[model samples]
Structures are given as C-alpha cells and as structure tokens.
Target: MNAYSGHTYKFTKEDNTFSYIKVHIKTQIGVKNLTRQEAVKLAGEDPDYLVDDLFNAIENGNYPVWNVFVQVMSPEQAEKYKWNIFDMTKVWPHKDFPLRQIGRLTLNRNPQNYFTDIEQAAFSPSTMVPGWAPSADPMLQARMFSYPDAARYRLGVNYQQLPTNRASVPVYCPFERDGFMNFSDNYGADPNYVGSTLLPTTFKTTKQGRTFSTLTEHEKWAGEVSSFTTEIGHQDFEQAAGLWAVLGRDPGHQDRFIGNIADHLSSVTYPRLRVMVYELFSRVNKDLGARIQTATEALIA
Candidate 1:
C-alpha cells in the first residue's frame, strides 16, 4: 500500500523560514490488492498474513523498499492556492506541485523483542525533529496533543524515558523528573528552576532576531475558532463522488464495492438507520445509492 502524509507539515530553516510539505512513500514493489472474496478467505485462514509476510521477507534478506517524495508548497503559493493548504481532507494536485524525491526507506530488520521494542513503542506526531513542525490542520493539531497524552497514560508519565522511546540525542530537561519508573540520573543535584546560573547548564538558543513564520491576515480571519459541529453539505460528498467515478474506470470494481457495502448494510436491523446510511451514500452518487439499497434489501429479504 502507498503511504501518504495526509497532514501538511512545515520544513523550517534555522532562520525560522519554512515551506509546507506533504510526504508520499511509494512502495518499490508496486501496489497489489486482493478481491473481496480473497480477502475474506485470507482473513479467516491466515489472520496474520500481512505481518508474517513482512517478517519472513526481512528474515530472508528480501528487504522491502519505499521511495520517499515530498510535494513542497511555498508560503506564497499556499496563500493563493485554490484549495486550503491546511485542509487534511484535501490533497495538493501533483500537476500543480510535482513530487520531489528526497530519500528511500527500507525494512532491513525485524524487532528482536516484541514487548520491549514493539509493545512499549510510543508514536506521536509531536515527536518531530528541529526542522519539522505541524501545520494548522484541525485533526493534526488535535492528534499532536492527544497521541502523546495517550502514550503517557499507557506507558506511565516517564514513558519518554523508556529505552524504545528515548531519543538518541541527549535531552536535558531537569524539570521533568522523579515520576514513576524514572531510572535516570535525575539531573544529579542540578536545581530544577530555570535560569539557575549556579549549576551552569547550557541550552540551545534561537538565532538572534530571527522571526518565525506567522499566519497571514486572510488565514486568521477565515479560520474557524469555534467548537467542531457535524454540519453536512453538498461539498462534503464531492470527494466521495470523485472516488466513485475513479472506481468506475476499473472493470467490475464498482460492482464489487457495491456488493461489499450491501453485505454489511444488510446486517443492520433498524430500517430507519439503514435508510440513513443509504441517504448518506446517495449524496455521493444517486445511482450507486439506489443500487446499494436494492442489493441490501434483496439480501435482507
């Protein structure tokens, strides 16, 4: 499967100038998909099919590789773009902003210890390098806060101190000390207060008089500053309709998709709820919605 960074991120310079970018990781082996029937069979017979496949490939030295590309959008371009750059649901068209190859990622080795390496592993979008930063995407902003909070809850307050999650570079934040399972030196007699000249600690300083990029006047005025509400409109179904049109280009794809939807939808006992589901898809495509309703009713009958 092709991996995409749905959220836009900023690539900042030491001077605080930044470019917004979306990352794409395309598999070198190409994309392959199984039919619904095949997927169902494999799900029952070999529930761990995908994980086992990757592990075996790495064990046998047949490493899987993915080519990484980034679509960079300058701040000026972002301001004038047709679509909002910070919208997570929208994508920057390649025709307008082509992909630039940055690097390759290879799965060369498997985890030695599942519990220590895999189970204890904590992943958060907030755990980024100096040059990388998050954009104003609503979902991304929420995830940046929520994911780290989840990791703290799951692995304890000192989760960052765990071997698997610890940063390779030395971190010296004396303020964050003496939590449960804290096995570090605990900053050894250094005063926990900031700007303590008595201990003489060195901290990274930002470039003198370098101003970071700020939101434009239009962005600040246009962006919402209220609680999220479930407001539906015609524009909400535009992307789904586009995807349905794409599936139409592939032979039997649309039919299979409808069949898959019908199968699950038939299981819903509440008639009113089933009608609501059909209505939601109808907003995407009228014909597809009708087909799904027919197929689902036949199955239920």
Candidate 2:
C-alpha cells in the first residue's frame, strides 16, 4: 500500500524561509488491491491476514521497502496556484511540482516486545527536527497540538520519556518538569525558566547566527489577528471529481467505487441522510450523484 502525508509541511532554512512540501511513500512492489468480495471474505476468515503476511515476509528476509519522495512548492508558486495550497483536500499536481526522491524506508525487524515497542509509541507533527517543520495549514496546526495532548492523556504526561517515544537527540527543557511518571530527576533542582542568570542555557545557532527558535519568521509574520472562515463551495469538489475521472482509466474501478459507497449508503436506513449523501456527490459530478443513488436504491430494493 502507498502512503501520503496529507498535511502540508515546510522544509525550512536558517534564514526563516521555507518551501511547502507533501510526502509520498510508495511501495517498491506495485499496489494491488483485493476486490470488495475478496476483502470481506478474508476479513471473516482471518482478521490479522495483512499483519501476518507482512510479519512473515520480513521474517523470510523479504523486507518491504518504500521509496520516500517529496513534492515541494515555493511560496511564490503557492501564491499563484489555482487551489489553496494549505487545503488538505487539494493536491499539488505532479506536472506542477513533481516528486523528488529523498530517502527510502525498510521494515527489516519485527517488534521485540509489542508492549514496549508498539503500545507505548507516540507521534506528533509538533515533534520536528531543526530543518523540517509544519506549515500553517489549519488542520495541521490543530493536529500538532491535539495528537501529543491525546498521547499525554492516554499514556502518562511523561510518555515522551518512554524508550519508544524518547527523542534520539538530547533535549534540555528545564522549564517543563514534574509531570506524572517522570523518569528524570525533574531537571535536578535547576531553574525552571529560560534566561536564568544563575544557570544559563545554550541555544543552538545556525551558521547564519539565527538561534534555533521554534517560531520562524514565516510563522511570525507581521499581521494583526483576524477572524477567518473556510467556507465550502463548488471548488472544494474539483479535486474529487478529477480523482473520479482518473479512476475511469481502470476497468471496474469506478463501478467498484460506486458499489463500495452504495453498500454503506444503502445501510444508512434514513432517506434524508442518503439523499444528503447523494447531493454531496452531486457537487463533485452530476453523473456520480445519479449513479450512486441508483446503485444504492437497487441495493435497498
């Protein structure tokens, strides 16, 4: 299966400039999908079929690898783009930005202890290195805070101290201390704030003499606070309609797409709800809405 970082991010420079980016992780072995019928059958037979397949493949020395590529768009290009660059619904078309191969990921080892390795694992967009950071996409901004906060609630506040989640690079933040399940000595009685004359802290600086502050100039743009609204319109469905057209290239894929939706839409049990769904699809394409309605009605009948 292929993976994408749907959210927009930034590849930043020490000068506080950045290029907006999206990540793609494509499997070396081409994507293959089981039909809905086959998927349903396999799900009932063995729920862990995919996981077992992956584990056995790795164990048998067939390490599955994914080539990591990034699509980068300059701020000027972003400004001139037809669609909102920050909109997660929209994608930077290949012809416009193009993919650049950067790295590869290989799943070579299975977990030694599932509990320590998998269960305790935590991830957040806010956990970024020096050169890479998140864009100001509203959804991305919300996720940066929400994901870590959720982990803190589920695991103890000191969940980051866990071996699986701990940062590989040394981090010193004396201000943040005395949390639940704290592994460290809570900074060992150091002053609990930055710029303390008693215990001065060193801030990493780039060769350009810019201190490594989380706040970038792009983020700290000179602007007064203002209310914003993301109003949905016909433009919102343009990319979805484009995807539907792309599916037309593959035989039965479009029909399967409609059937997949119809299966669930037919089970909604509310006429108004089903009608709303059809109307939503109508925004994408009139034919798609009619096709879905007919298929779903047939299934119900």
Candidate 3:
C-alpha cells in the first residue's frame, strides 16, 4: 500500500528560499484492499498477517520497495491555492502540483534483536536532514515536539545515544550533557556555555547555510502574533464532496466507502452523537449523508 507523510514540509536552502512539499511513498506493488467482512475474518484468523507477510517477503529476497516522491509548490503558488497550504487535512490536488520522484526506499533486512533494534528505535520530524526542513503546520509542529518527548519518556534522557537512534555523523553540542544514561565522554571539560574570549566555540554559522533550526527571514510572517487553529466552514467540505464524486468512478467503491463508515458508526451507542456525524457528512453530500444514516440504522436495528 502507498504511504504519505500527510503533513506539509519545506524544501529549503541556505538563502531562505523554500518550497512547500508533501512527501509520498508509493509501493512498487499496487495497492490492494479487502472488504470489511474479509478484513474482520482475516483479523480473527491471523492478527499479525500483514507484518508476517512483510518479514517473510524480505527474508525470501523479495525486498519490498517504495518510490519516494514529493508534491512541491512554490511560495507564490501556496498563497493562491484554494485551501490553506498549512492545513494538514487538506490535500494539495495532484493537478496543481504533480509528484516528483526523489528516491527509492527498500526493506532488505529484519531486526537482529527486538529489544536493541526495534524497541529502542525513535524517529521524529525534527530530526531532519540539511536540505529538508519543517513547515508551520500545527500537527507537524506537535509531532516535532511530542514524538521526541514521548521517546525520552519511554526511553531516557540520552535515548538518542542508543545504537538504533544515534546519528552516524559527528554532532557538536557541548551544553547537552550529564543526563541520565549518558554514554559519551560528557564532552570532557569543555565549557558548557560559549561566550569567552580565551576559548571560542567553532559553531556552524549562517554563511554555511547549515543553520536549519529555525525558519529563514522570508518565511516568517510580519504581522501580530496570534495562535492558529483551523475553523470549519461550508468551504471546508468542498474537497470532501469532490472526493465523493471521484469514488463514483469505481463501481463498488462508493458502496464500500459508505459501508466502511456504517460498519464503525453503527457501534456508537449515543444517538445524538450519530446525528452529529450525519450532519457532518451532510455537509459533504446530502445523498452520502442519507446513505450512511440508512446503512447505520439498519445495522443498529
């Protein structure tokens, strides 16, 4: 199946020139889906079927691969886009910005040990490479902080020192030291803070274009500071209506979409909550909302 980062990020340069991007990883093998009945049966028979299949495939030399691509839009294009470019839920239409293949990702090996290789692993959006940077998306920002915080809570303060999470390249941070489980030399006797004339810290400056910790000058908004949160309006449902129309192209896809909603929604015990759901879907399409309500009521009755 294909995977998406589902959050807007930035492809940036040292000069502060950046383009908004959404990362996509398309599997070499086409996507396949089972109906709700089939999925429930499979879950009962073998809950770990998908993971087992992936591991077996890799062990048998059938390495799973995905083509990594990015949909890019210039800063100018973002301003003119129909939806807010920073909205995580809104997908940038492919017609406007097509996929550009960046690289290939392959899974060739299984973990040697579950505790060391799998359990200790940690990943965060903030741990980005030089050319790649984060955007102003609220969800992305939350993950950038929450993911690392969760890792630290689950693992330890020096969780990054673990073999699975450690950086291969040299990292120079003299201030971050003496934490629990710290395995390094603790920077020996280096100065914790750098402001002395006798000894100077060799820091990577802006001229080298390596200072990616914050947004560049052009990226910052020049207005008064205010917190941002997405507010729903009728316009918010337009893209959803478009998607419902697209589902009609495949004969049973629309039915499957309705069924998927009904199967889960029918389990809700609260009648008021169900009505609220129906009203939400009504914004997308009246027919869609009616169909979902009928199917759910049938299951409930």
Encode model 3's per-residue lDDT on 1-301: one tens digit a residue: 9999988888877766888799999999888888989889999999898889989999999999999999999877876677777776689888889999999999999988979999999999989777687777778888999999999999999998999998898787766778899998988877776666757644533435355434645356411111445677887888899999999997999999999999999999999999999999999999999999999999999
Q: After superposition, how far is residue 30 of candidate 3 from its true place, in Å?
A: 1.2
- Residue-wise C-alpha lDDT for candidate 1, range 1-301, written one tens digit per residue: 8999999888877655778899999999998888778989999999899999999999999999999999999878877786667777677878889999999999999999989999999999978766677777777889999999999899999999888999998876777888899888988886768675666544542345443433333345235531343777787677789889989997988999999999999999999999998998999999988999999999999
Local distance difference test, candidate 2: 0.84
lDDT of 2 by residue, 100-205 (tens): 9999999999999989999989999988888887777888889999999999998988998999998887787765688768987777866667574766456653
Give all candidates' CA lDDT scores. Answer: 0.83, 0.84, 0.84
**TM-score of every prediction relative to native:** 0.85, 0.89, 0.89
Q: Could you give me the TM-score of model 1 versus the true structure?
A: 0.85
Which window of ten consecutive residues has the lowest lDDT sum in model 2? 220-229
Q: Which regions of candidate 1 fall more than 4 Å away from where they truly are?
A: 196-231
- Pairs clashing within candidate 2: none
Query: Model 2 TM-score?
Result: 0.89
